[model samples]
Target chain A: MRKNYFHPKNLDGVYSVYQIEGLNQDRLIKNLKNGGLTLYNVKKIANHKMSLEISVKQDKNFFAIVEKMCYTNLELKPKIDKKRKKLLKKGVIATKSECGYNIKLTRVHGKAYPLYYLFTHVGVLIGAIIFCLGAYHVDDYIFSFEFTGSGNVVENRVVEYLNSVGVEKGKRFSEFDLNVLADGILAENPLLSYAGCLKRGNKMVIELVLAKNGTDILDESIKSLSSDVDGVVKELKVYRGTPLVGVGDKVSAGDLLVDGVISHKDVQIETNVLAKVVVLAEFNYTFISQFDDRETHAELLAIESLNLPVEYSKITKQPDKDGYLYTVTLYYNRVFVAG
Target chain B: MSFLESVKEIIGLEQFPAPVFRATIIGDVAGFFEGVVDVQTWSDEQIVIRLKKGGFIINGKNLYLKKYCAGDLVVCGKITSTQRI
Candidate 1:
């Protein structure tokens, strides 16, 4: 006869075991069915000696009810073998006979899913959301300009100059040749000594250092002098030699504004100090103007994965009349200066 | 072994006095009685044995068998019986 026994290798869900005595065959079968135990094979080896094999699905608390029911049986002297006792000592294993039908019941009850799969799914979703947000927040393309020296220049004139040379605010710094732009702006105004253009993060900065022109002085040899240009007298300074013109007198260019010689008694002393004065002048001029009134837009061009370049609208000027016109151009760039 | 040789061996040429030399304690010098090349005699009742680091002074009241002189070896015990090297 071929002897057949339960194979531990094949029983993937067996965790622990429990031995029970004084249970009638009929009562044991009834209890097994009521307890939701799915018996795989039941063989009666001898008088009251039976070998029962079963299986169950994996769950966290599948054998809890069976454990409680077995404890309540007062007449049952459960003698567990060494293997079953060792499994019971571990405290988490569900025996084959107790775990069988309960495994199916738990499937119906909706449980038993791998935890790693759930965590991985959540991680992927979070990663995708973060990636999208980063893409939206990134400012890839940037261009700007800046100005230096005295900021008290006419705004419209600078803007006009910038527009004429295609160096407007929204335009990319790389589009304009910085050296050529500097030369053009300096050519328009001889008063500016050095003009520079550069690019910073999202901005273009332009710097202009003004020429140091000497102020006009007056000689005290003149009898009287008055201002030729209309202006508010800001300051009046006196030389120690002689008075060419008294207080409250306005003088123009090429006029003897002050006297350096002083006549006292029989000696005439010549002083070296030159008289200086400052006046705030406002020159008023008018000319006809025309504007496109069209909204300007920018276009971005990616140079590489990290670098981006941009372009802007073109500007054209139309002649209106033969008169004095003030044109101001402001070109912004990002720049650094060593002090 | 012969009796004479054993007797000579028992009574070694080097004699040691009782109350073997232990250690040294420095204090005010009691007046000097005599001075020699390898030894010095003090008027006080103790004798001092000089070492490289310090000196060991022995009291006359603890002196047992051997007589201590200004230039004597002043042996306290056999060299092997001494606790120090």
Candidate 2:
């Protein structure tokens, strides 16, 4: 669509700048014009050197004519357009070097942001927003649950207990209290020495530690007998010590039920004694739980290591007029420590 | 005219026109039909273009041959005036 302004009908119009050097350059111009090519702005700076503008579309014919005329040196440079020529006249470029361009900005006004980039790549911003929203929403609920120390615990029982306590799938993890879950699972399971509840991302991990059960050793090392659970006494027998709790008496765990210091004819003899006490009917608990490490599960482990008459305990929760009612059931009655 | 003839005339595809040398002079641009024989004098202030028979001395400031084809010459500069020789 671009036609030469001068020879609009004859010349190809696409101009290119070239430096031509040769002897008898005046003859070269005549020869080039005769060769069906248009030359513009031919400047004869010297007898042998002339800079000129020629249509690039006639490049083949121009080169052939130059070669035929024996013009040895010819170099092509970038054509300076009208706009760039105007800028050159204004001396906008204060310095020039080959390494790089150090642009000097001048007279820029108005406050603006790089909103062009955001507008150009809207899909990336939308995708990032969606990812963040998905992450935030997914974090509110636990997706999957994994069990450790599964060999000693029943998986179905754990799942059932979780569902019963409203800790099942699609439930918000933040809604259920972790400590309540840990203690609830710990108190119910006799074999699990520790129960830990931990939430990682969308997955719930429960770690249970199995207590090591051994034969009954009536070692005289145990100084006195202590109650292992908070429950009413079902039966009691004292062979070598006086019983401080009778039947139907509610005693808390860690309470000394039989004392090592007893009055033997007012002699104040201090010696270990043997006693047997049974609390609530024995029961077994199976559930999923997680224990982080030794330090955190110490309290749960301490309860199990006591090795008292109550080998395990279970807690059942119910809604009553006075908020929630928690019932503690002590079971797994073993022979009281033969202290 | 036919569509084909119009297209050729617009693209300069038709054969060259008659050789009667004519210069269409404008304020700063002067175009000539039918080429000059040779450039007798060329400078920033003056240009002497030789024709087949006679020539014209165009005296101006920054006068140069804007383009010169087989028989077409375009002279562009700040023209004070022109004279025939």
Candidate 3:
């Protein structure tokens, strides 16, 4: 059997090349062999110098002997191939190299590249972030208003009504209900028949339509205004129907004051239109004078929608003292509402 | 084969006291051998290796120990001859 000192285990992991030029190089080789170090490619090129390959895994032991023996005339530079490099990374490794400087090359390169970019382009990155933030929130505010209509509309009233309903410039449009805003616009202006609010790309579009009169008369059936009470007409105003009785005309009950039938002089056809008229009749309203005076509906007349409007007031007899008569005129008009 | 040699082969026991030694020269490019006890003499031209059975002298040009592991060694050079001394 071969002795253990003659051939040791394979020392092929992470080796380096070294050249030694000193006196008694033979002694150095002898010391290396006796120290149980494996050597490869031991060549003698000069009389007192030789070069050899030794494993880097024995860095501390190999350098300890070299430094102790004052072998200062030697140079060692690690030459790594793929197989030896894998061994150094996985299993056998030297903590600090004696052949080179005490510096780590890979860690510095891995950490510095990112920090360099971050420190150099900080302003551009911040600007990009702010731009993205503004783009995300731009849809909340309203900027312009565009009004469109078929007829003439008061633009200022629509704008004012929208602002009063909390739909204004720079306000979040979603906070205000669109339906309420549209209804308020129609109510504030009596002239507008329809009001619709449309939101399109940060702009509010108001659509207005004026009321078309005389076009919505579904019942063109000939109608007339008849007096329900017997009195004298004090004031009379006609807006649509023809007036049959003028002011100071004595009218009795069941009398037609305005005629809906109209006969044209040039045309042969007779047209029937709805009668919209206002008549004020004189009435002697008498009330018992109590110690407490209370207002009554006898004086005030609203003239609301009624199928049968009062065209005259009848005075029966004069009351004695407490029943003294005073005149209360009432306004009666047939208003034709077209929505 | 002798009786002890064949028994040792069958039992997988290594030949003791005198290890086997053999040398192969491949077209003067390299030489390989095993069971070496020591590197006796080394220079640029020759290297004398001592084995258990005997010793060997290798003469060549630019001869170096390519590898030595577990008593197995390789020598590469332009070899003129190899002789057992």
Model 1, span B1-85: residue lDDT tens? 7774576569873354322222322232121212111222221244444433344444433222121233223232212112111
lDDT of 2 at B56: 75
Candidate 2's C-alpha runs over 4 A off are A1-13, A45-48, A76-339, B1-19, B28-35
Q: What is the C-alpha lDDT profile of model 3 across A102-139, one tens digit per residue? A: 21111111223343333335776677778889865777
Q: Please, what are the lDDT tens digits per residue for candidate 2 over residues A234-304?
A: 76777786678888887777877787777878788767777667665443332222332223233344345
Return the TM-score for candidate 2, rounded to 2 decimals. Answer: 0.32
Off by over 4 Å in 1: A1-145, A151-156, A214-339, B1-85
Clashing pairs in 3: none
CA lDDT of A130 in candidate 1?
89
Deviation of model 1 at A103, angstroms: 18
Question: Which is the leading candidate under lDDT?
Answer: 2
- TM-scores of the candidates are 0.22, 0.32, 0.32
Per-candidate interface DockQ score = 0.00, 0.40, 0.22
Whichever of 1 and 2 has more TM-score, that candidate is 2
- Top candidate when judged by TM-score against the true structure: 2
Worst 10 residues of 3 chain A by lDDT: A101-110
